[model samples]
Target: MNEVLDDPVSQTMIDIHCHVLPETDDGSVSLEESVEMCRMAAADGIKTIVATPHLFDGVHPPPSRDDIRRKIDLVMEASGGVVEIVPGGETRYSHEIFQEARDKHTRIRLNGSSYMLLEFDFMMVPPNIEMTIFQILQAGLTPVIAHPERNARIQLKPEILVGLIERGAYAQIDAGSLLGSFGKECETSVKQILRAGLAHFLASDGHHQDRRRPLLSKAVSIAAEIGGERYAKALVEDNPLALIQDRGIPFQPEPDLAALRGRAKKKAAKSWYAFWR
Candidate 1:
């Protein structure tokens, strides 16, 4: 069991996605920034944050497992154990990458659990998303699609997200999107996903100390307003905690695929009409 799970104290929030490791990627620039990020999370009532640096994207190679462990230890120590940092990786989409993950040759799984945080390009969904998600499930890991609501493709065609969910992949909504920090399009997508019960987790994809900080209180409140209190808490707290502990989400709700497609078609029709106007 994780030390966080072992502790009896209850935490109101758990951010499953955060780039808080110092100098690891484009996240916190230094050790002080990483510690400051933890302070910010703790202040926002976030007792746990997964230190997910980017992996296998041809951008920046992730740190070694040993280095990540060392940084987690350093950050935890610096935070005086107020907040726990779990090990994870935000991996880009690719058949080979998902294959490696399924083979258990990669430690990039979230907190060493069977849940993998998978990301697609902002402007497009991968052509092999369905097959890749099937492969992930076959490999004994669940694919948690990171911040689908922020993806331009998903924002335009939410049916893409409905398809992924129907194929057994989960979706994580960015806290910034719910808080309208990303933009109007992302915020609209957040509301749509919430309405369809497709958003399974909420995370602070916190990259820096101030601008993209680990602030989730407002997002949580907004989620509650949109989906009711139980659903809201499940997104930011219950589901993420279960992922960290390698347990199934206690409040998994079935995605409303029919409603999602209907909304997407209606939106598309409106756009087509406007194009001719």
Candidate 2:
């Protein structure tokens, strides 16, 4: 039986990232395309999908929360009995936007979830990234890092990611990367991160039908084969569900090498022998 069997069919699936907002960023270009994306998601049994359109500094300007809400209503009306579309924005991370987030703008969070899905640039990472994340925590919102494997900086130096997790930030890998959909570098690094137990979330991040359609299940199978099915469920469902709750989601601290320093000594000292005795 699948580890997913733990949850009933209705609760088995939730997509944390999708771009069903019409003519927004590089995602669905029209209402028709948005409906198609919804249909695709519904066809695959995805009950909930958070529409994560892009927001950045100098790049594509993202729509505001109100705009996202209106569009969500539009999607719901145009769903054609497809999938349920919720509101989330792939928010940009920079010290510049940090003030704006607190003062001017707020985006849609995961449906009834405290976690806000966010992403960084493909090229350079934000300089004061850690401090900004601390600020986010201080403000009482959890930041779910989107597509860490696609970031060139993190791919080059994976430990940079370890530092982020240690600071209480969670990482979400793109489903397409598991299928080598991004490229060789992203695919290789994503697999490595999964083995390292660095990935806590998985998302479709689908942009279109012909190329970037939703593939959460396929990615789940890939993760199951590589990292065990249980880990896959946690990455896709358990961790995400924890984030969705009203209070802050408490997670085990990031995997730390220092804590594993005395591994062999403890392994030999294990109390499993008591059970056998």
TM-score of 1: 0.91
| Model 2 global lDDT (CA atoms, 0 to 1) | 0.74
lDDT per residue, candidate 1, 147-254, as tens digits? 999899998888888888888889999989988889998998889899889899999999999888887888889999988999988888789989989998788787
Query: How would you encode candidate 2's per-residue C-alpha lDDT over 1-277 as one tens digit per residue?
Result: 1132324234366688888788878888898888777777666657678788887645668687788889888877877545667777777776544554564235635664557776788886778888877888786667888899999988766777788778878888899999998899889778878877788888899888778897588899999897788888877677665655544544343464443234324544554665577
Candidate that would win on lDDT: 1
Q: Evaluate all candidate structures by whole-model CA lDDT and list the values in order.
A: 0.85, 0.74
Return the TM-score for each candidate structure.
0.91, 0.82
Candidate 1: list runs displaced more than 4 Å. Answer: 1-10, 102-105, 258-262
